[model samples]
Target: METFITYVSQNGFYIWEEFYRHFLMAAYGVLFASIISIPVGILIARYGKLSSWVLTFGSIIQTIPVLGFMAITMVAMGLGTTTVITTVFFYSLLPIIQNTYVGIKGVDSTVTSAAYASGMTRLQLLTKVELPLAVSVIMAGIRTALVVGIGIVAIGTFVGAGGLGAIIVRGTNATDGTAIILAGAIPTALMAIVADLVMGKIERKLNPVNKTATA
Candidate 1:
C-alpha cells in the first residue's frame, strides 16, 4: 500500500499523461474505424450479397494474431505512434462494422415500409427512421470497439508507443512486478469503466423509451 501510494504520488502526472495519450490514440483508431465501418455496414445491410463478402473479409482480418499484426505494422510503419494507431484502427473495425450491420438490418421492416409509404425518400428513411432506431445497438458496438482498442494500445508500448504500459515495462525491467501490474491493470480498468459509463449514458439518451419514461 505504501509503495503504491508513493508511486502514485510521485508519478501521477506522468501516468495520467501517458494514459491520456494512449486514450487519444485509441479514440482516433475507433473514430477512423467507425468512419469506414458504419457507412459500409449500412450499405452492406441494405444489400445482402455485399454484406456476406465484407463481413467474411473483416472476419479474416480479425483472425490475425494481434502481436503479429502489430509487429508487421511496426516494421512497415517503423516503430512509432502511427503503427499503434493503424493497428488499433484495423482491430476495432470488426465489432463496429458487425454491430452496425446487425443493428440496421434488425430494424423493423414494417417501420421502413411505413416510412416509404409515407413518402419518405430513401435518404430520409435511412437517416430519420432506421439510424435513429438503430443508434443504441450501434453505440454498443462502439463501446466494444473502444474497450478492445484500449487493451491493444497498452501493447503498443512494445513498439515504442507510450502509455501506462510504459510504466509496466519499466517496472518489469526493474524487477518490480507490483508496479507493472498496478500500472497496467488500474488504468486499463478505469478506462473500461469510464468508457462503458459514458457510452451507456449516450445509449440511454438515444433510446426513446428511456427518454420518454423519464419525462
Candidate 2:
C-alpha cells in the first residue's frame, strides 16, 4: 500500500499523460473500425448472400494472434502509433460489424413493408426506418468494440506506441514492479468500466423498446 501510494504520488503526471495516449489510441481505432464496419455491415445486410463470406473474413482476422499481427504490421507500417492504431482497428471490427449486421437483419419485416407501401424507396426505408430501429443493437456492438479496444491498446507499447501498457512493461522488466503494474492495470480497467456503463446508458436510450416501456 505504501509503495503503491508513493508510486502514485511520484508518477501521477506520467499516468495522466499515458492514460490520455491510451485513450486516443483506443478512440481512433474504435472510431475508424466503426466507420468502416458499420457500412460494410449494412452492405452485407442488404445483399444477404455476402454476409457469410464477409463475416468469415473478419473472424479470420480476429483469430490471428495479436502479437503476430502486430509483428506483421510492423513490417509494413513500422513500429509506431500508426501500426498500433491500425492493428487495434482490425481488432475492433468483428463485434461492431457483426452487431450491425444482426441489428439491420433483425429489424421488423412489417416496418419495412409499411415503408415500401408508403412509397418509400429502398434507400429511404434503410435510412429512415431500418437504421433508426437498429440503433440500439448497433450501439451495443460499438460499446463492445470500445471495450475491446481499451484492453488491446495496452499492447500498443510493444511497438513503441505509448500507453498504460508501458507501465506494465516497465513493471515486468523491473525487480519490484507490482505497484507499477497495478497502477496501469487499475486505471485501464476503470476506463473500460466507465465506457461500458456510459455506452450502456446510450444504448438503452436508443432502444425503442425501452422508450415504449417508459411511455
Candidate 3:
C-alpha cells in the first residue's frame, strides 16, 4: 500500500499523460469506426443482401484474434501509433454496424407509414423520424465500441503507442505488480465509467419522449 501510494504521488503526471494519450487514440478509433459503420448499418437495415454481406465481412474481422490482427497490421504498417489505431478502428466497427441495423429495424412500421402519409419524403422520414427514434439504440452500439476501443488501445503500448499499458508493461517486466494494477486497472475502469456517463447524457437528450414523461 505504501509503495502504491508513493508511486501514485510521484507519477501523477505520467499517469494522466498516459490516460489522455490512450483516450485520444480510442476516441479516434471510435470516430473512424462510426464513419464506416453508421452508413453501412443503415444500408443493411434497408437491404437484405447488403446486410448479409456486411455481417459476413464484419464477422470475419471479429473472428481474428486481436494480437493476430495487430501483428498483421504492424507487418504492413511497420508498427507505431497508426498501426494500433487502425487495429482498434477495425475492431470497433462490428458492434456499431450491428446495433445500428437493429436499432433502425426496430422502429415501428406504423410510425414510418404515418410519416410517409404526412408527406415526409423517404430521406426526410429517415433523417427526422427513424434516426432520431433510433438514437438510443445506436448510441448503445457506440458505447460498446468506445469501451472496446479503450481496452484495445492499451495493447497498443507494445507497438510504441504510449498509454496506461506502458506502465503495466514496464511493471510486468520489472516484477512490480503495483505498476500493472495502477496503470492497467484504474485507467480502464475510469474510462468505462466516464464513457458510459457521457453516452447516457446523449441518450437522454435524444430521448425527448422520456423527458416529456418525466416532466
lDDT of each: 0.87, 0.92, 0.86
lDDT of candidate 2 over 48-137, digit per residue (tens): 999999899989999999988988999999988999899889988888999999999999899899899999999999899999999999
Q: Cα RMSD (Å) between model 1 and the true structure? A: 1.4
| TM-score of decoy 2 | 0.97
Q: Total clashes, candidate 3? A: 0
Candidate 1: clashing pairs of residues: none
Clashing pairs in 3: none
Q: Candidates sorted by lDDT, descending order?
A: 2, 1, 3
Report the lDDT tens digits of candidate 3 across residue range 106-145: 8999999999999999899999989988888888888888
Question: What are the models' TM-scores?
Answer: 0.95, 0.97, 0.93
With a 3 Å backbone cut-off (N, CA, C), the pairs that clash in candidate 2 are none
Ranking by TM-score: 2, 1, 3
Candidate 1 lDDT, 1-215, residue by residue in tens: 67877888888898889889889989999999999999988999989889888988888988998879999988888987899899889988888889899989988899999999999999999899999988888888898889888888888889999887777777777766685558766987899789989988897888766767889
Worst 10 residues of 1 by lDDT: 176-185
Instruction: Kindly give the stretch of ten consecutive residues in candidate 3 with the minimal lDDT sum.
Output: 175-184
RMSD of each: 1.4, 1.0, 1.6
What stretches of model 3 exceed 4 Å from their correct place? none
Pairing residues by index, what is the TM-score of model 1?
Answer: 0.95
